[model samples]
Target: MDFEKIQNEIGGFSRYQVVVITTVAWLAFSAGFGTQSAVFISAIPKYRCAVPPIDDPDVYPSLGESDIKNYTIPYDTATAEYDSCNRYDYNLSSCQGDGDLSCVTFDEDPGTIPCDQGYHYDQTYYKETTRTQWDLVCER
Candidate 1:
């Protein structure tokens, strides 16, 4: 009536059987690890609009990327996050002409659209990967 007793009477695992079981277990573990890691490959890293850089050394040294991110990118105060895929369509020459020389966030409007150039993503954890290499953020 006991399956273990019946199997023992029939014969225990042969060396070949043990090898097959070990190989299958290893393969199963590897397959599960690979399946779980698939999402991280396309994982979208935190990103923001990559606006044109200021060539002026005077301005470039004075400003941080965050400053440009604040000025050129739209932020949602309600969510406290910058619009990942959209940027404010502002004329750089005009913005520079204003000479305010300080970051100013504008309200998100119809002008908000997907980044015209591309995006900037954090490369801390990941190197140039599928997501970062392809600029796959926001709508894209």
Candidate 2:
């Protein structure tokens, strides 16, 4: 029941002890905030492509035995049409031609390409290789 003795004992704390207690509290607060922020960010869903697959022989037949090919009409995602005459390795293939063109073979890098008629290459991240598709689409 002695108030003065209890007050004196509680007030007697060394500087090092106070500093250690403050640092522990700060670290705990920072860890909690960081974990909550990461959880919130991971819960959000991302946007993705909704186009259907293209599997027609006439629309996208194999390249014939011709030596020289003509102007290649790359794949058009908007119209779901793919040209059959273009040759692409990993390097220089157009997305409008095939979906398997990666950077391991052909010298054409996977990036955007701007044409004369306002046509451009739309780059998207596929499994191992990046994909390109024509961005031009008809309005409904």
Q: Write the per-residue lDDT of candidate 1 for residues 33-74, one digit (tens) a residue.
A: 789786556766688776655423354666566766667778
Cα-based lDDT for every prediction: 0.68, 0.36
TM-score of 1: 0.56
* TM-scores, all models, native as reference: 0.56, 0.26
Candidate number achieving the greatest lDDT relative to the actual structure: 1
Off by over 4 Å in 2: 1-4, 40-46, 49-140
Error of 2 at 106 (Å): 26
Backbone clashes in candidate 2 total 9
| lDDT digits (tens) for residues 3-115 of candidate 2 | 77876787865787789999999999999998877434332121122211112234235533121122223455787644332222222323344433222233453332323
Clashes of each: 0, 9
